[model samples]
Target: MYKDLDEFITEYQHTADFWYDVGCVMASEKLSKFGSEDWQELSSIVHNRPLEWQKKLAYCLDTSCNMYELEILLSLLNTEDEELFEICIDTLRSFTTQESKQMILDNPSILNRVNDLLPKAGIVSKKMLEDFLKKLNA
Candidate 1:
């Protein structure tokens, strides 16, 4: 688990250090989000994967996250934490890449879940999600 998103991104991008390598990922809060491996305690604490760190994951959702990070990303959509929620929204909206659009299109559950959350979203977030959904559906 990362202390914040930058560290998560840094580690994933391979900009951390040459030493931080192979340990694809680790889940947040000491829980195994993906169950890939026992990420070394120090490395996970120091850094973790390599594209946006596996193509910069948030940007590569369509390329790399389809099977692994999708659930984590989806879970973040409901967070009340302002910072995290913002990152989630920003990362989600960045899915405008053609492949990312297809990622959402391929997963109807993404739409369904977003729709389900509409009634619960705050005014600002609601509007953002609405526009996001519209673009994807369009």
Candidate 2:
């Protein structure tokens, strides 16, 4: 769907409401087997882009996306870009399952932010909280 990660990231960064249903579908397809190559490519997109551009890409991550694309979004979230972290925290809150919550909590950098924001988003179970804490401790 995308010529390359840079081209795709650039488009998403510059386009408004870029993460439409069609975009999500394409992202899902591309990320079905997201691995080292894809991660390196996406990370390069984040590494080279400016903060504002990365912020827009983060907004694209906030869309209604399938699990595969969400995982790719999470991979992008691993970037040290603070803007991406902020947007990812918000996106994680939008998901209503322990699986999504657990995924967010697995990242130490985002865990506290997600926990702080989750209450406003909705309630999370005690077991989920314990598991997340355990994951961090481990």
Candidate 3:
């Protein structure tokens, strides 16, 4: 278990296991403190990492991120990588707030892709996507 934020940064910065360990630490009982800088750093990491690392970090960010961080996740919807696109959509489903839904709706490409892909991926029911689209258009 990590003792504190600095310890986590000092030990885990720049490693293959960084995100996985960060996720574990975030989920653990240690109660790591995250400031704006920490969140920004994590967001940068998410944006810069490869698809696999982004996938792993997405799981961590999903649980810990704020709305701004969530927008970072939403941006991943534009990725041409099929697996990453699916993961972003699945993660976005949990964020049902108006802002998130609007973000999805505002992006025609993302909205169309969600309509196209969700059915094939089976991440969400077709009816649910239809309802969501209805809400967006309303």
Candidate 4:
């Protein structure tokens, strides 16, 4: 749809009510696909950009969050970047059980990635993730 992730961001990242829709479509088209130009390029945007973009990128993970992406998302809590950490927790906190189950089923082999993170996560991060996993079990 656009030349690169930045171009897509320029085109779609905005205050419109449709940003989530844009994010959902982008996740389906790009974030879920490993090694595609858009996929490979996402980490740079998340780290190098300002808070808005990072927060918006987190929104993209709101749906169809694969294990590969989830690993990175979970890793954000280990960062000193408060903005990144809060958005990371917020994103995980917002997930419903249906979404959690679907994500686990879709990426069953990587379920341990989430489990393994529990013990190493920071106190707040661990608490949030624990509540999250409980929903997964429910």
Q: Which digits, one per residue and each the tens of the lDDT, describe model 2 over residues 72-124?
A: 56766666655466565445444655676566566666666546544654344
Off by over 4 Å in 4: 1-3, 33-40, 62-64, 78-86, 93-133, 136-138
Candidate 4 per-residue C-alpha lDDT over 22-73 given as tens digits, one digit per residue, 9 for 90 to 100: 5547644655444544444565455666666665666566545555456556
Q: Which is the winner by lDDT between candidate 2 and candidate 3? A: 3
For candidate 4, report its TM-score: 0.50
At residue 116, what lDDT does model 1 achieve?
72
Model 4 lowest lDDT segment of ten: 1-10
Per-candidate Cα lDDT values, in order, are 0.48, 0.54, 0.59, 0.58
Q: Which residue pairs does candidate 3 place in steric collision?
A: none
Which one wins by TM-score: 1 or 2? 2
Q: In candidate 3, which residue ranges exceed 4 Å CA deviation?
A: 1-32, 122-138
Best candidate, lDDT: 3
Residue 37 in candidate 1, Cα distance off native in Å? 16
Candidate ranking (TM-score, best to worst): 3, 4, 2, 1
RMSD of each predicted structure: 10.6, 7.2, 6.0, 7.4
Which pairs clash in the backbone of model 4?
none
Expressed as tens digits, the lDDT of each residue in 1-138 for candidate 1 is: 433533655544344332224222432322333244422332343223432333333332322433344544554444444444444544576455576677657767657666776898889878887888777766
Give the range where candidate 3 is weakest over 10 consecutive residues by summed lDDT: 1-10
Give the per-residue Cα lDDT of candidate 1 at 135: 71
Model 2 bad stretches (over 4 Å): 4-48, 113-138
